[model samples]
Target: MSVTKALEGAVGWLTLNRPDKLNSMTRDMVETMAAALKAWRDDAAVRVVVLTGTGRAFCAGADLKAGNGAAAPQPGEKDSLDVIVDFFDTLRNFPKPVIVAVNGLALAGGMEVVLSCDIVLAAESARLGDAHSNFGVFPGGGGAALLPRKVPDNVARYLLFTGDSLTAAEMKTYGLVNEVLPDAELTDRARALAEKLAGKSPLVLARMKRVAANACDKTTADAIRHELLELRDHKRSYDIQEGLRAFAEKRKPEFKGY
Candidate 1:
C-alpha cells in the first residue's frame, strides 16, 4: 500500500509508506488519504490526526514518473491536479487538528502538504522546498497560495523562484515549522504533542480551530463579535460546566466533548 492508516489512542496516524520512492505521492495514495480523513472526521474517539512518512523521507513530492510527469489528465482518468486540490481542501476543512511530522525531505507537492497541515514538527535534518520551478511546473496544489500566508512574501517568493531547499531550522526561522527535533526524537515529540491536545475537550478544540481560521479573514470588530457568538454557543456544551466545577474543586477537568 502507498499509504497506511492506524490509530494510537485518540490520535489517528496516516503514514506514507513508499520508502523506495522516497515516499513520493501517487494518485492512489492521495485518494486513499482523502478517504481515510473523511472516515476519521466523524470518529469521536479520534481527537487529532498526525501525518508522517515511513523510512528516511517524509515525501519527495509527486511521483512524476507514475503518470505524465506533470499531474496532467490521462485518457478517461480524473485530473490529478483536481485530486490534490480536493485533498488539501479536506485537510483545511477538517475540524480537528492536523499535525505533520516531517521526518525528512519535503519538496514541491510534499511542501504543499505541509502547508495544508495545522502544525508541523520537523526533524532537524529534514529539508523543505518548492521545487516545481526546477521542473518547469508551478505549484498545482496549495503551495503558491498557502506558503505566502505562513512566511513573508519575499521569503516565499525566494524559495519558490529559486527552488532552494531550507533546513528544518531555517524553515522554523521562517515561522513555517512549529518545532525542530533530532531525527530520532521527531516521532515521539509529535505524539506527545498530539496526546496533550487529545486530553482537551474535543468539542472545544474543534471550536477553537474554526475561530482561529475565521478570525484571520475577519475585521477586528467583526472578529470579536463572532467570537462572542461562538462563546455563547460554547457555554451550552457540558464540558464548560464540568471545567468550571473542576477548577473550583481543584481537580483536573474531565471533558465529555459535548
Candidate 2:
C-alpha cells in the first residue's frame, strides 16, 4: 500500500509510502490516514501515533507531477478541498497527541500536515515551507492560518510571503519543533516520545489534551474557568475509578469505554 499503516507496541506509525514522488499525498492516502486516526482514537491498545513520510521528502505536497494534480493546479471536476479540510479538522481535534516525524523537505500541503500535529520532531537536515503562494493558490491546506499560530507571526508571514524554506535549526529556535534529531534518529526519537505518552492513563491523556488545546485556543479563559468543572466530571468517569482501582490492585486498568 502507498500508505504504510502499522502499530507496533504502544505507537502507530503511518508513513507516506510514495517515495517515488517524494512521498506526496494523493486523495486516497489522505483519506486512509484520516480513517486510521479516527479508529485509533477509540482503540485502547493504540495510544500514540507517529505520522511520517518516506525518503528524502517528507511530502512534496499534493503530488503535482502526476497528470491529475499539478503545482499550478488546473481546474478540476473534482472537489479536493472539502475532504482535505475534514481531515485537517480531524488532526486539529485529535484526542491523542500526534507526532509528525519530519525527515526531509515538507513543502506546501505537507507544511499543513506538520502544523496539524500535536508535536513535531524534525530531522536535522529537514526543510519546511509553504510554496502554495508561489504556485498561485491561497494555502487551502491550512498553512496561512495555522502556521502563524504554530510559530511567530512575523516568521509565518515571512515564510508565506517569500516562500522561503526554513531549516530545521531555525525552526527549533523559532519554537516550531519539539526538537531536531539526526536524520537517522528522527523515527526512533518520535517513537520514544509516543511510547512515553502512551504509558499514561488513556482517559487522563485525552482530557489533558483537550485542556491543553483549549488553553492555547481562543476560548482559553473560559476553558480555564470551567476547567475544574470538566476535571471533576472526568474524575467521576468510569475510567478514572478503574484507574485508581487498578493502581491499588497493582494491575492494568481495563477500560470499557464508559
Q: Model 1: per-residue lDDT, tens digit, 1-258?
A: 889999999999999999999999988999999999998998888999999998878998999888576555678877887788888889889999999999999999899989989999999989999988998887887788889998999999998999999999999999999999999999999999999999899989888888888887899999899888889999899999999999999999998789
lDDT tens digits by residue: candidate 2, 1-258: 889999988788899999888887877888898899888887878888899988898987886554255344367644567668878888879887789999899999899999888888999989999988787767777899888888899999999998889998899898988899999999888888898877776677777788777776647678777678778888778878888899999998766434
> What TM-score would every model get versus the actual structure?
0.95, 0.87
The whole-model C-alpha lDDT of candidate 1 against the native structure comes to 0.91
Clash-forming residue pairs, model 2: none
Model 2: how far residue 143 lies from native, Å: 0.6
Q: Any idea what lDDT model 2 has?
A: 0.84
Top candidate by lDDT: 1
